[model samples]
Target chain A: MSKLYESQKLALWYFSVALVLFGAQLLFGLLAAYQYLNPDFLYGVLDFSINRMLHINAMIVWLIMGFMGGVYWFLPIETGREVVGIKLAKLAFFVLVAAVAVVVLVYLLVQTGKGDFFTLWFITEGREYIEAPRWADWGIVAVMLVFYFNVVATVIKSKKLTGILGVLIIDLLALAGLYLAGMYFTPNISVDQFWWWWVVHLWVEATWEVLVGVLMAWALMTVLGTPRKIVEAWLYLEVFLVFGTGILGLGHHYFWIGTPEYWLGIGGFFSALEPIPLVAMVVHAIYDAGSHKLRAANKPALFWIMAQAFGNFVGAGMWGFMHTLPQINLYSHGTQITPAHGHLAFFGAYVTANLVLMYIAIQRVRAPEGPALDSRAWKLAYVGFVITIFGMVGALTVAGFAQIFVERAVGGATWSAYIAGQEHPWVREPMYWRFGFGVLFLLSYLILIYDMLTIGKRAATATEVKPA
Target chain B: MIQGVEVLYLIGAGLVFIAGAGLYALLYAYGKIKGSILLQRSSYLFALAMLGGVAYIVAHPAFDTFWKSLLTVCGLTYLFIPKSMLWVMERVHLREEEERKKEKHNPFYTNY
Candidate 1:
């Protein structure tokens, strides 16, 4: 197939995988949240830590797939050239598919008592092991190289490239850093734990934040009919703020470890500023949308974009700053407050940003000339997402604060103290509400799936655009 | 015994890691709030200075706990907190034309 066809195919492949993964994430999230409420909901079958691992791993992979899809759509626009190598792109796709299957297979095998290659968690069995073999780890890394090569090759061949390519290059370099970091460490949780964050937390939060800023700016500009140059300038400023100051924020994760208290202070201080770019995102988005509100009366795509910008501001920027203080983070780092920052920042900012990319991709590929968000159903999904996100953030924040109070007042300093404190009425109260609100989030996904399928179908047939 | 050196190595490694991470955080915050390339550039330079200081202390292995701890804490706090929180939100505004319209509460509102 031609490169254009291949790009379309790859785009669909990414969206399909992402939706499936998102579905899995919603289910696992519900399960994990359920465990918190009942504590015995699936006690015998699935342990909390194991389920937690799956929840996080699934969320990460799905988001990565979404990012991959977004960049494929973006490369053409940023470079003004179709991606160069069709076969290589397809090869990367197949590898990624196999890699995911390997992960799922490994997860299931780790759950069962068949084999034990790499322990996943310590539930009661012979320790949790990698559901897939170690080669799968290296295999995924190889696939990453393939992806980096494809994008780099395309950009190198293009006569002109935008600073957007700088964003992509940074992601590539970070992945390389993560791979090297991964190999530098061992699988032992005790020692490997901190270094793993070097890849997991830092790479995802810092480098990926840069990528999201650029991609979101690109997508919003396209959908809002804003100028590319204007968007590019905003993107450049955001990227500089993120990397220029964001890399140090990684220290926040290092605090409780054997690392010095100084790290906690520094991490806390610098991360306070981490939200500058996020604040900029929200401010810019609100301004753009509000300015165009009268002109662009149609609000489906723009609504989601605006919502994403606002969500990122609160989720990534404000909430992140709240915990960046050493005094606060000292108490909240491993506790529920971390999750409060996590759910919003990850879901609200990062994932929602990617979703906007999906919306733009569909709009562009289909070339719908009519008013965006014409369908009542799509509007419902957008509102559903907003409501669900708001509910989750509110619930989690209250729960986190309750947890901190209980830990300090009732639980004391030992492991037993912490566990005993879990039984407190205050802690238990918010746990129930958090789980209750989580169900609303699950329902939102059902609406999203339905809306995504029917997006471009009824567009007056006069427009001959293909459905994404 | 090998165990003694192992413990020392671990401690030394921990100090180095924390120092590097902490310095980076300070540099980032300083650069971001100022929106000054010069400030950002100088922050990176200061981070290098912190690294060098930490390396010196590690290599020297002094027992002046009070001084070392004070330096560490001071370095860490400086590394993390931007010299000015007042301008951070405002600098965030300067990045985008759209954001400036919505928020007039810039920390530098009076000066500007």
Candidate 2:
């Protein structure tokens, strides 16, 4: 497990890119948070719309890079072959990096253009998360296709299709194919939204989750030296629960989007069940920790995976269930509750998943022929994790609940309700707390980066390596 | 009356109930695993205490029949979800074993 294939070096490149983008995402996120408290903070210099777009887009780019990096790193490990088209894969990497840089420059420098097809094609499509403009979208698709082709060829060459790689290919295909769902425009707003949710909801809820499943299974095996049968068993069970609940869980989003009345029942019912899988995953982690006598060969990597489990449970499962029921969504829709759920879910599920891979990758690449490195930064990062997950998320949740009551529950979406919700003491006060925690998160990111910058290069004495 | 934490508490009750139930499932499934008996037993104790908290949350002045019923269903479903997961795991393991046997290789480690 400590030894990495030489081809795994390509993954480090992707992770390094991801690290920069993740930092940018955080900066933009903090900017958006500040704008919430003070709209005039950036004023015309950097509009909230622009800042928020960068925040979200940067997040998507960085997290996807994490996925690609993890896949590249592990594919060789699983299949016993280096990635096919390695030179092309690296070329695709540059194309993607350049495309991201161009898109951001265009977003900031050229901000907006006419709403005609030209703007849609070149400048901005004005969609929420996938706002990379149409041309860039095509470029992204091409890059992903290269990544996909490399993975497929390697799997074929390996002549061995383990459960993890098998599911991984299917997920990669779905991942690439689903991005197309958000590319085109529709005449009807509902139809447009329907397709939009295909990209947004399905990616996070479906493909990304399956991707996490594969990665998590591999990670547990690598870190815990758990038997393949047990991990694969959990993988299959997770797939069962995720597809059973998450697909229809999109019904919650469908409820108000001009969908059928049946969605109310379906969405409410399925979304409630959504938390079941997350809880189940958390339980499985407990089982592993208990059965293994509470030790992981790679503690930092396992810590993030455990964080993914609990964080996703509290954030996506519990927080989502707190409001996703049609009855509750009635009052919490479009409130800060949405962000409250989103921040935790994204941080818990995907961000932690990436961190798990990064920690593992860093560990492998940093000290290949040596004992396990000390988890100096992880100890510090743990504090940041709590501050962000608890302090920041708690602030937003309270703000959301406050807004839900003032705006949706009592005021019922009236004009006055919007204003009252905005002015509510609960809502306004929590923003300051959110900003405070965000600063702490920044400090935490610096500590993590410090670790990233100088892990394993030191001459310090090595920690005792546990037998995996 | 209805603006603040009353609703938040209801959500907390349902989640707490689920956590307690999930802990029970973990204890039952992995209670024999080494060194966690006290941890699991204390967790079981907390699970029992959580029930009392759920009761208080439900009995709050917001206690309407619909809310109470919803809470009940949430509690019961979670109370059994871990059991259901265990059953599903057993079934999955059996299927995996069958697939591996038929293919004469571990399905997870080799193509089946």
Candidate 3:
């Protein structure tokens, strides 16, 4: 067995926590889908709003956890030194996990709007994904500060300043900066919406894009022995592309939110451009793999990387572009189209990025030579990936299109009318499809977690069984 | 109600579009070029120029429909140029590799 680094053990613990949260996220996702089919499925026990909040909150928290874990694992390797403040890193993990636990407990138990400030602190700010209470937000920010300090200190101490490290550090700092935008509360809806996009759009489309690029570049170089020059060049291009286009892409959300008419053109045009980087990434990976005859070691990692590329293109890129236009978004704004894009985009972009990181960490610790193609875990994971991807894309696309057609295209324009239209058979039927697919998605994650846990043990047993 | 300077801006947008297309062509020919350092450098410069143009446009007077259209076209062109470049370069590289493989296997071929 390969000797694991101490920092890597911290990463594994983070991954284990993230995996559990991922499973919890899927459970809440299924519950939300179930509510769509049968609104009374868990009416009082777990309301739709609560379920949806849990789902989104769990996803955002877990993905951040995954990113933090990945940073800890890769930073030491890139720096050629032990992680600075190892104790602080572990503390950050525990603090974050504890914060999540408190938030989840509060979300499940406490009811909001009791006219009490204490409830507000414990319950939430009541915004969509930023629903975590003020206290939870403070906890998250605190943990993030510790993580940021550790990463920055490590980089500053290192002699070499690689392009990947530069991008990662800048991106992490920006992530911390942008997250503060969500903490401020205001009565002005337009101002609130503007800053919210600073957190949401910037984090998802801009900062996270840079993070993914650098991390993916590093992984490709480390695993495939791809030339650093080429990967670094692509990283630079990605930074240019993301910041140049993605910042203006925020104009898209500004469209119907009482913002200026000019945002319509800016948002539509710039957001349309957002997909170009994703497409470039997919092409970059394909070309790099073809040009280099590197060993296909760590097949699962490679598969997830490709999935990250293609999935982001389709989910965040294509699906996002679909409704990003002012005309289309005018109709699809609050409809199921939003959630459809949300599900696929988040899954494709962040979820697969985390999975790729996890697979890399797993391959490093468990199977340095590479896991066998026909290993039970690998086979099951492949099936799980396919089922989850198809399940999400198929169900969500059907649901979103059905929503646009029934609620907006045919029905009248008012919000009440849209809500009434959702009751129609056409709209509600596709939701059942989403529910079914959600089950498959949950099952896929269960299989993935099992595979993650047992792959090393099974490999060791196989080696023992073989003749020496 | 297009001013003379706005017309110049429109013309500048057109020029940028053409420049973007030209950059795409250069990127497509990346394999034939000895090194991509120049290509990479040009991409950065192009990105900087685009940022400058965006700043200039945004800082000017209120954006009418025509100006909005101009900016929109410029942004779209800016977005696709690099992507198209990457796509074309990959294809060109693949084609070159295939040709090299064919040349190597030719029975009549001899190393100098």
Best by lDDT: 2
Q: What is the Å distance of residue A162 in model 3 from its true position?
A: 1.5
Candidate 2: residue A437 lDDT (0-100) = 91
DockQ values per model = 0.03, 0.21, 0.05
Give the Å shift of residue A159 in candidate 3: 2.5
Name the lDDT value of residue A331 in candidate 2: 69
User: Weakest 10 consecutive residues, lDDT, candidate 2 chain B?
Assistant: B103-112
- lDDT per residue for candidate 1 within A1-468, as digits (tens), equals 113445656876887888888888878888888888778887767777667767777788788888888888777666767788857887888888877776666565456554343342222223222222456666767777777887888888986666668767777778666755654445555466566667766676677877777777666555654554566667777777787667888777777767767886567556655655554454455346544552442345566676776676667655665555454455555667667778887877667776776766565454345434456777777777777776777777766665565664345446876875577676677777777778877787888778777775565243544433
Q: Which docking band does candidate 1 fall into?
A: incorrect
Off by over 4 Å in 1: A1-5, A112-133, A186-191, A294-298, A371-373, A460-468, B1-112
Q: Candidate 2: which docking quality band?
A: incorrect
- Maximum-DockQ candidate: 2
Off by over 4 Å in 2: A1-6, A459-468, B1-74, B84-112
Better of 1 and 2 by DockQ: 2
Descending-TM-score candidate ranking: 2, 3, 1
Error of 1 at B88 (Å): 14
lDDT of 3: 0.70
lDDT of 3 by residue, A223-339 (tens): 555555556767898899889889999999899888888898889778757766765665565455545532356666667776777677667765676566575566667766677
